[model samples]
Target chain A: MDAIIFLIFAAAAVIFGINVVLRTHPVSSALALIGVMASLAVIYLLLGAPFLAAVQVLVYAGAIMVLFLFVIMLLNAGSEKKSRGAWMARLAGVPLLVALLTILSFVIFRMYPRSVGVKFGSFAAGTVERVGSALFTTYLLPFEITSLLVLIAILGAVVLGYKELD
Target chain B: MPANFVPPSGVEYIRVLPEIILAAVATLIMVLEPLTPAPRKRALGYLALAGFAGALAGAAAAGWRTGPAFSGMLEVDGFATFFRLLVILAGLLVTLVSFPYLRREEAESGEYYALLLYSVAGQTIMVSAADLIVLFIGLEISSIASYVLAGYMRREKLANEAAAKYFLLGSFATAFLLYGIALIYGATGTTRLNGIAQVLSDPRMAPAGILTGTAVALMLVGFAFKISAAPFQVWAPDVYQGAPSPVAAFLAAGPKAAAFAVLLRVFMTAFAPLTGRWLAIMWSLSLLTMIVGNFAALLQTNIKRLLAYSSIAHAGYVLVAVTAHSEEGVQAAMFYLTVYVFMNIGAFAVVAYFSRKGERYVEIEDLAGLGVRQPVLAALFAVILLSLIGVPPTAGFLGKFYIFQAAVKADLLWLTVLGLLNSAVAAYYYLRLIVIMYMKEPGDSLLELPGMAVSTRAALWTSAAAVVVLGLFPALIR
Candidate 1:
């Protein structure tokens, strides 16, 4: 049963990875990337890193992807045909597909030996409690620094966007 | 590996006093700007200059000190002190030069100076950053301020274009760097430089993952872009030409120096084992940059664009020094950068002087017979141009001498030879400017010196004197 679930998640990840490149529309490509992120989160859950799965959803899917989408919307992107000149459009997909295939092959080959060490069963080894402990103790400086970074970003945006008073 | 490290107590906060003072002073200037009306705005620049001087003194006071403050996020050491001095000096000169340019360019000068000081504060933090996260943040603060300064002349379309290009390219490079850091974090479960080194040293820690190599290469590319190395240096000429000349001078000098400092520290200390790989990469980059930068500079008619290419050539020379991968190499590169700051900024001040009133662009033809018209300024500019071309009896020559000597000591004889040839090729263009100023007939009947404010004039003459004085006694720095 666990093997079947892993296979399903892996297949979805692969498909979404392909779609992220091949979908002509940037919106579709972005949505496909989100799909890939979700599948990766499930893979993290299966690898006994439940906290990583949650954080992946929260950070990657919830915040960062939304910001990406907002920028896309703010820029008012046009259809895929209008996105780039014909020459750029032709060259873009080739590299994307090539990178995807290369990464896929490498992942498959590298994982073959490690599959035994990576148990597919759900485990509490990387639970929320463990993550909280790590965040507060071992990773405390970086954690606070990350929050400060976000605050700085917010402050920067406000300062940049505000109009000067006449 | 000193496990179970705890954050330092409040006393550690004193370690970053210079940076803190800079930030405070910058904020004070910004807040006081609009409240104090124009004409009084000159006070803002004075305040910033005084603040930067204080910060420089503070940094010098902390000289040669070694400690990891803020949980090893920032390390104060001899290396950091050396770069802090360079950065503060660059900031001081830039602020001084900008006042006259902004007064004439019709832009609000106060905010510009404030932003420059803020950026200097960021650069100070950057050279001292011991962790990847702190480094990234410092890079951002400096870069973002630069983008604003680049486009500070908002009404000028060229300035806007330059800023846009720089911002887009910078953002892409930054993303690549961040992703690289994330991969390193994933591999070692740590972002501290020492911790990463420890993990890489342990044979069992990192299991021959290709991703780790790719991540490092990507990070190198990102840094290469920052310092405007070849293949990633497309933005340098255009951005340098389009931005205001004073800001261009800052970009060419300060930030590039800071970036190289961090790049040297990270690669030499933490990733020493990987030198076998990156040394090969840097060699190609240095050679290509030398050839391309020198040859391209030959065709430029605008003095600013010519200096931009010259800067690229200088970057190549610095990279050759970096390729040495020794203590002497790092020190040589640092010393060379100091000389570079004075000469480059002085040269740009000459160009900015010509651009006053925005009525006349300082084309090569306009410089014809400047030797006759403004003999003193022309002579000063000639010394600076000679220095840039690595001629004897000037600061630039000694800088090149030190770097090449280090290169030879490192057994990179071929690189040193190639460097000599590149300098020879570069001399043609610098001499062309001198010839244009001296030999050619005047295109305009009378070429008056562009009127600069008192401080800008003082800055130009001061930098010129420093270059000649420093050239005469390079041992002072040693």
Candidate 2:
């Protein structure tokens, strides 16, 4: 049952990911990206990572997408005029991309043979409880430091956005 | 409760005392910015300086209780202490140098100092980080603050360009680094440096060599870009040229030093078992960085761009020490970076003062006959120039001497010889500035040049004194 759900969502994600890149209008691309994010979250759920799935939807599909939409609207962006492609990229891009995918998959398959398969509950580390335990214990420093990082980002936004200094 | 929270010990709190103080002070500065009134903005700078001083003392206090903290996420050893001290010193010096520039540019604000403090705080975490996740977060904090600082003068087109280019390239490099970290975690199943080392050091416990090698290469690309090493260093000259002078100075010294600390820590510890694979890459990277940094610098007329290239070349020299991968090499890199911070800051301080408003007199020729007008300032700048050229008795000479000595000991004879030759090549541009200062006749550039501010003078004299004093007493650091 999990395998079937994973396959369906994974296929949807791949399709939406392509749509994201291929869309001419920035808003369309952004909307497609949200679709990709939602599908990926469903896929993550199928993989037994409920927490990651929640974050994928809440953060990427929700909050981040809103920001992207704001940027698009503020810019008053229009459909990008398609240029005659870079000749070199047009000629070599697809073949090279295929070659890279082939090599990566070959390496992955070699490292983890088909005899060893994923069992849903066997992947034990992705649960919220385990993550929470780790975050407050061994990972406490990085977890707390992340707040500082957020603070700096806020400070940077204010500095750059504001006009008057003196 | 599913999540059993381990209450952190007092020792862990003390271990990060400096970072805590820096963040607290930075937050306070931001709070006080609007309330303090306009002209009193100078007081904000002093507040930042106080923060840096307190953090320096905090660092010293933290060093006294040296050990792993927060479950080994941060390790406060001598190595961490040295770098932590180095970056805090950088923050303090850069802030001192910034006062005059801000006053001159009529852009004095508390955000500048607050951001500087935050950047230094981030660097403190970076130097002490034992986990890759912490390293990445610290790196982001520093880079974000620096990007904002680079474009601090929102009116300036060049500043905007600098910030945008730096942000884009920096984010790209960081993504590469994150990908590498993910791969490493996949291979070793851990983010802690020592755990990764323990796994990799045992052949039976190690994962596929190809995965580990790829991870190293990606991370090297990331670190190379951060330090502005050759092949990935196209952004440095442009970014430095576009940035405000004092900011350029801070970015060069503080973040670069912290990044180097992370590079050395990660490579020397987690990736030690794979040294055989990476040593050759380091040799070539060192040579290429030196060659590119030197040869490109020769054609530069802009003083800032020239210094930019010089810093890239300096990074190359440090890479040679990394290639050596010995105790002495680490020591050499450490000593080299210490002098590097002082001399580089001193050089930039002179540039900041000379540039006048809007950085008008930034050309190499602007210094013509400076010795005739402001002989004291010119002479101080000359001392810094000589040290940059690696002339003996100066700390720069000792820095290069120690690095080369380590290289020779590690059988990097060719790198040493070539690096010596590169330094010889480097001497030409640095000396050219000195020659123009004394030899040529005074031009129109010096006519409007204002007398030095007290803070600028202090920054100059302190850096110059450090350069000469560290030279005279090598044992102070060595």
Against the true two-chain complex, what DockQ does each candidate achieve? 0.21, 0.68
**Over the stretch B292-353, how does candidate 2's per-residue lDDT look in tens digits?**
99989999999999999999999999999999999999999999999999999999999999
The TM-scores, one per candidate, come to 0.87, 0.96
lDDT tens per residue, model 1, B244-355: 8999999998899999998998898767756776788888888888888899999998888889889999999999999988989998898788888888899988888776
Model 2 CA deviation exceeding 4 Å by range:
A81-106, B1-5
Off by over 4 Å in 1: A1-77, A80-166, B1-7, B204-206, B209-211, B445-449
Candidate 1, RMSD to the unseen true structure: 3.9
DockQ of 1: 0.21
In candidate 2, list every pair of residues with a backbone clash.
none
